[model samples]
Target: MTASNHPIVGILLLAAGKGTRFTAAGGEGNKLLALYPNSNGDQVPLLAFSLSQAVASGLPVRLVTRPDEMEIIAMAEQFGAAVTLVASSGSGETIAAGVCDSANWAGWLIAPADMGWLRSDDYVQVAAALSSDEAQARMMFDDMPGHPVGFGKGYGAALSQLTGDHGARQLLDDTKLVKLAGHSGVVKDADLPAQ
Candidate 1:
């Protein structure tokens, strides 16, 4: 799991969204800070759960969030993830900044902060694929393409050039992407307060 084995592969957790939907769903706080109980009866904030998984995967991880989310930044740092506070403009801007900051990295495994259910194994698989010489990019999904896409070094410049709200989907369309077997959690995003 060292960068030498997977040179460009780094975990970038995108958490800069405004979470307007969650707010509309009666979430009075940052969606990333919303609490959810685990089976062990430990109450954890939604974002913390995701960050734990990323850290457990043994990859260098960077969390991108808004300036106001110092709580999330501190939490990520506590878990040993490198953190970057990007403007809460859109996914594209946040992602672009992350890619730039990790420019030395050979690839990126991008995940949304809301996908608290993403399995650690799924992340391992994507990173494994990115480590291979043939994989330019890899995507996971249940029945369709979903979040937590892995991009190789070949797409670095393109990813850094991204702007606005558009995500890496366009990069997937333009590159040779390898798809991992579907996992329903791949498409599940915490869009509402109850989710």
Candidate 2:
């Protein structure tokens, strides 16, 4: 589809996961709720920071979160994102929920909520690349794959069928993925309090 003729490419922010690993690794409470210092000298919640960046990208955003996450739901709504609630705390479930919630979009840029360090420009750059390319694309940092993975409209069904905790790893391996050089923050995640 032509760039102008194509449907809107929205951002799917996955925030439903339990972040059990982070807590198991000694992190306190939910990792998404943990405060992280931003460049503005303010400590912001990880998920809130990530959602802000997604909103700043100038694209429609859909946030998948748990029903109990009132703070996250409020932050997402404040950012004007369409929120979808899921009972299971799984990446695949979150992805499916977000995709199903915004199924009318032309495509989606799936991003993990833990990657709070990614800037708005990063999302814009990846969206631009995905819009121009015929195949799916993903951010690559120092030869490693990164998040905000872009998928064309053709893969909507496959993305929606996702389940369990693997997210879209299988789709990435099965599709024609174009790798773009994303900033270092693409590879960064709030896995620990010190990070």
Candidate 3:
């Protein structure tokens, strides 16, 4: 059966963070809105690059962003993601909103929007692996945990009830994980310009 025949494992692209660390470190504005180099070395908005990767997964993508981020909203729409606006910029809040918005989906792959280094194929592979299993999963590159963690269908309520900045870390601790190795980009994020 094709992907459509299976229950959807939607991508919950989290983009509502305040990015205090980035800005405090001398990065401009919302880090997601800052221009960053893509794999091809072309400059594009950081969130746009991450959204591109998530959309390329061929899974349904629902992005949670701040209402003030019009540029990020436009980029998400352009990339074909269903957008949900949240007042709070907390990571947990963003995840909850996105997961609740996509509540009917069979599962969710929660991806941070600042991780511009990720490739489209990374999302694809993670979705594929998660679809074949019941356990939660995460990508590990060079033995380091990374973004776009996969939570199977069973964790919807726990995920929806999440709050604060701790975005799924506690819930993940309560469950077993299936770690898969992938490109080093999984461990890279745009928290700083040099990173």
The prediction achieving the highest lDDT against the true structure is: 2
For all predictions, the C-alpha RMSD in Å is: 2.3, 2.8, 2.1
lDDT of 3 by residue, 1-195 (tens): 767666788888888888888988889778887887666998788887788778877889888988988988888889889999998657888888888888778888888888887777777767766754366888888888987798888889888988999999887743478788878889988778655
Candidate 2 per-residue lDDT, tens place, 1-195, comes to: 864555788899888888877988899987888987777978888887898889998888888889998988998888898999998657888898888888888788988888987888877777776654245888889999998798888788998989998988888743468788988889988776755
Cα-based lDDT for every prediction: 0.81, 0.83, 0.82
* lDDT score for candidate 1 against the true structure: 0.81
| Candidate 2: Cα lDDT at 40 | 92
C-alpha TM-score for every candidate: 0.90, 0.91, 0.91
Candidate 1 per-residue lDDT, tens place, 1-195, comes to 854654557899999999999998888789888888876988789888898888888878999998878899899899999988878578888899899999888688998988888877777788877855335445556457775798878788888888888877677744567778857877877888864
Tell how far residue 46 is off in model 1, in angstroms: 0.2
Q: TM-score for model 2?
A: 0.91
Cα RMSD, model 2:
2.8
Clashing pairs in 1: 8-105, 8-106, 8-107
